[model samples]
Target: MIKQGLLVRAAVPACVLTGGAVAGGVSPIAWATGLVFGLALVLLTGWGLQRTGRGEFGPADWITFARATLVGCAAELIADGGHPHAWLVGLIAVALLLDGVDGQVARRTGTSSEFGARFDMEVDAFLILLMCVQVAETAGLWVLAIGLMRYAFVAASWAMPWLTAPLYPSMARKTVAAVQGVVLVVAVAGILPVLWTVAAVVLALASLVWSFGRDVVWLARTRVPAARPSAIVAITRRRAAPHHGPTWPAHNQAA
Candidate 1:
């Protein structure tokens, strides 16, 4: 029933976006891409909810869902394959602004959970990636690094599980992550000169690299070492040792 509700809720936006695209005379390919994105979003969200044993979407999850829908529309615009339209920029801006909002909603509504946080983060990452694809057309391919960095880290975590360890909260990390979206939006908006846009993207990428590098280093440093057989045996012995009074000085020892 919950999944059925989710599908019903998701279909509204999907249809609206598709209808808008078609009405605006967007290419079939672009609207089709939006549908594909919407479908994937629903499937993934449902899978995540099932994995986390969540039966209903929280208030913040709904906000994130709205943001995801906007992103899907933006993807359609970006897929149209030209300079971003004013509407595209507006959609992304709203999505980015809502990024902060969902968290606040989650916290205030007491619906915050691991699943919600991960869901928000993935949406943010995807929006950044979608913008990168748009900006890269003009800003150069290097701009892609800013978007792909998080994904690369995720892929690396598969090989080095330590990379998946939770990171301590840092304002700098959050600020850098936020900057990527803002900068990409500006770049895609074409508000700045070509050179300036490229430069802004470069700085965003650098900050992202620094933030991720710091996290990687911290994860590496804090990772628990796997115990060897000898180490395990020694630890077990220490744990199993019987407690006794402290040893007396040699002079006081019994003969």
Candidate 2:
């Protein structure tokens, strides 16, 4: 089952690369990069499935895999440096549109799992990062922050373990994240005036900052310190103690 699932997943990248070659005359560099990205994505995903003890890809995972393929194509386009704006924008737009679909499918199908959720999130993050790269060419390098913030927060968690706590779901956070992709895609499409594109990206970044800050503060407030070894031992001992209280009431005893 796993083998078949992986083969199916592998085909996505193959099709994407072939389509790019025929449609736009993919440069050697772009073709090579796309192949590497596709191979790495397949290998890593296979490793993850093995590590997680999953036998086959779930329905939602397939959706996320498709989205990831689109990102890979976008990366190839970025590498080629002569991609049509319409093609790039179309790929990203479809990917973004399918973003919410995977979650809904997972929920309805009862296949939701940590791996699936993480896979979905990683795809979203990478897409945003790629879009940021595209937008930065015109919007200024400050645009990269919108993509790098999540990774920065993740790195901070290694030093401050409290930041690793699971965050409560907030619609505001989801909204902020969704906005980043939409805004970046718009900026990439170059439909808006330069000033307006800059303004929209600025607003997106601001919202992202606010969302991350709010979560960090909440984490700090609710942070619980890890128990010391001695304290843990004491707790174990107390719980291990046997009850020795009398079973009879005082009146019955007197009688």
Candidate 3:
């Protein structure tokens, strides 16, 4: 949760700095001035925000928050717009280092929450999109498609309600998603050109496809049958449980 707050706050300033640097034409003097200012803001504000409040704040929260702020800055730096190459790469590496640590902080501190999970997830997503946009400028428009792949699945959930059902998380999948950003970042940094970038994009897309396919199959098989429960299971029931929850449950039951 602290990490999420850190990223959400950092994103705004990162975007602003990126724009300012680009608009100001990437002068060495301007870059140095902006770099110092950005670093100061990220450290002071991010650290302060993470350490705020008497009850919610803790060492772990501060640590994770610190990690996220550093990484988020790196992500913004590498994300096109004439950000310095060494600083951009350095920040990204720092972000990845903190990524592993933040969750440990949350777990050790016992401060993990849905808020934190969602916050981290969105931060990661936005970072991917940012990297995709920067990479696409060089790789090809098809590379941009990778950025929207997650959104495509998210939107499809509206049409196929069952698609929204959660599946048990896997570390392998998480690893794939995490590395996807790194691949694109490196690809755009010209460590690898269009050829390698395309391959990375393809593999990333395939990973998402596999994940969705498994979940869809699970939903199809495990979804409750559209009938009353067996007589034995129904013996102690007050009423049949709704097939869905809230919005879907109310509507499906009414229908």
Which residue pairs in model 2 clash with each other? Answer: none
Kindly provide the TM-score of model 1 when superposed on the true structure, using C-alpha atoms. 0.84
> What does candidate 2's lDDT look like per residue over 70-188, in tens digits?
88888888777776899989888999999989999999999998789889999999899998998998878999999999999999999999777665546778888878888898899
**In model 2, how large is the Cα lDDT of residue 232?**
32
Count of residue pairs whose backbone atoms collide, per candidate: 0, 0, 1
Q: Each candidate: what lDDT?
A: 0.78, 0.81, 0.58
Among the numbered candidates, top lDDT falls to: 2
Tens-place lDDT per residue, model 1, 101-201, is 98999999899988999999999889999999988888778778888888999899889976665555467788998788788888889899998888888
- lDDT, residue 225, model 3: 35
Clashing pairs in 1: none
**Model 3 segments more than 4 A misplaced:** 1-80, 224-255
Candidate 1, which segments miss by more than 4 Å at Cα? Answer: 1-4, 224-255
In candidate 3, what are the lDDT values of residues 114-154, reduced to their tens digit?
Answer: 44554456556655676677677676777766677778878
Q: TM-score, each model?
A: 0.84, 0.84, 0.60
Instruction: lDDT for model 2, please.
Output: 0.81
